[model samples]
Target: MIKSMTGYGVANVENDRYIISAEIKTLNSKFLDFNLRSPRQFSDREIEIRGLVSGVLERGKVNLNIEFTAKSSTNLPVSINQELFETYFDTYKSMASRVGVNDSSDLFRLAIQAPNVVTTVSDKSDDQDEWEAVKKVVMEATQKCDEFRKDEGDTLYHKFKENLDVISKGLDEIQKEEPKRKERIKNRITNNFKDWMEENSFDENRFEQELIYYFEKLDITEEIVRLSTHLKYFDKTMSSSQSQGKKLGFISQEIGREINTIGSKANDAAIQRHVIIMKDELEKIKEQALNII
Candidate 1:
């Protein structure tokens, strides 16, 4: 079914030992994009998350953030790398001998600056558990995100349906006055011939040809039919099970084409005014399509 690109959902997990949360927010976009804010240790999961989002959301400017909390600080002790320390200490002693600042305090300071010599007592197994928790919350958040998107989609569908109805009313007005417009053009041309044909013999064949050409040019029946078809297609796509943002966008483009043709072809002042109103309604529908998926 139609789903909006704009939505927000959050999911959380709580336990005696740990709590975790994940959130997803989306905005309109031509293609899928993501801005993920998460711990560095989980950076490797970026591709997986992207695939998951693409499968469900299809298209959007999506942003996600995940955070974890522990009820108490980890009690793991500090760790020191003895081999790394020895390498750093020897290198520092050599440098100190060269510079002639051979003091124990200076050696201690230099050794402290070495990378990986002292490190946190982080557990590899603990990391796996943390990832699992993150995955769980992310799944739950996606469920909520789907529900949120559907709720927004329902509202958008109503707005678009209203716009289509307004446009249909405008079309009806234009069609009702169609006969008057055609008659006005015919009368104008006949009056002009009466005034100008007195100068020379009237060219009946040329007048007939010109009348037919202008009549065809002003006829907006085909455009109106196409516009109606496009509107119907748009409504159908919104109810489809597949993600419909791209399809909806294409239908909107077709509708715009039809509207443009009608505007150019219908030279009547009243019809033009109504077309302007239709155009405004179409603009709003196009904006709504951007947020559909």
Candidate 2:
């Protein structure tokens, strides 16, 4: 079955030390484009998270957000660099004195806001436990996202089937009109030739040869057959277990070629109408195929 590239899933998992929430949203894309937003403490695990995402989702524009909240202050992930803070405080105070500004109350605040004054602390055992919890939530969220894709895929499958049936019915109508269309073409050509022959002398043998070639050129049998085959192939590919979006896109192009050929060759208005309907359905199929995976 096919899967849609667009979906959303969120999972929250909590433990004694921390509460982790993972949200994943995906949109259609030619390749995997991953963006991550998470606490700085999890920076080390970005690559691993990306691998997990690629393994599960395969292809899409992916946005993943991980919210990590410590349950208690003791489980905090950051620490103050006291030495750096003191250095910045002294620098700010000295600069203030040089500028004849004796207000030192805000110097502590400014020092704390200085770069590198706050940093993430990596505790091996606690980090391992927290990472494990984060992984659990992320995996659960990914599973939910896959399930969402499956549901969307199911909807697309029915829509595709509906359009395919319409196109198929249109093809049948065209086929039914084929004989009458040919008869009309033959009569019209013969009548035109008669009118021309009365006006001027013409070579009979060359005229017959040209008429045969003209009829052959107007024959739409090969195009109709190829179109039918492509439709069936599309159905088969859509029913397969793996992702076939690109393959289906290629098949749609072939179908379009056949439809256009039929439209150009079909001289009858009735057949042309059917061809137009088929073209419309084909455009719908192509548009929806972009969202498939």
lDDT of 1 by residue, 1-293 (tens): 67788888899999887788899998888888888887655777888877766677777898889876778865645688888888888888988899887687878777876888778764333477777788878878877887898899888888888998998898889888888889998899889878678878867999789889989988888888888888888888877777678888898899888888888877778888998999999999888887887
How many angstroms is residue 50 displaced in model 2 relative to the true structure, after the best TM-score fit?
A: 0.5
Ten contiguous residues minimizing lDDT sum, candidate 2:
120-129
Over 4 Å off, model 1: 73-78, 81-116, 120-129, 203-206
Residue 49's lDDT in candidate 1:
72
Candidate 2, residues 1-293, lDDT tens digits: the string is 98999989999977787789999999999889999998877887899999988899998899999999877875456789899999999999999999998888899889999999998777433467788888889999998998999999999999999999999999999999999999999888788778779999988899899988988999999999999999999999999989789999999999999999999988679998998999999999999999988
- The TM-score leader among the candidates is 2
Number of the top lDDT candidate: 2
lDDT of each: 0.82, 0.91
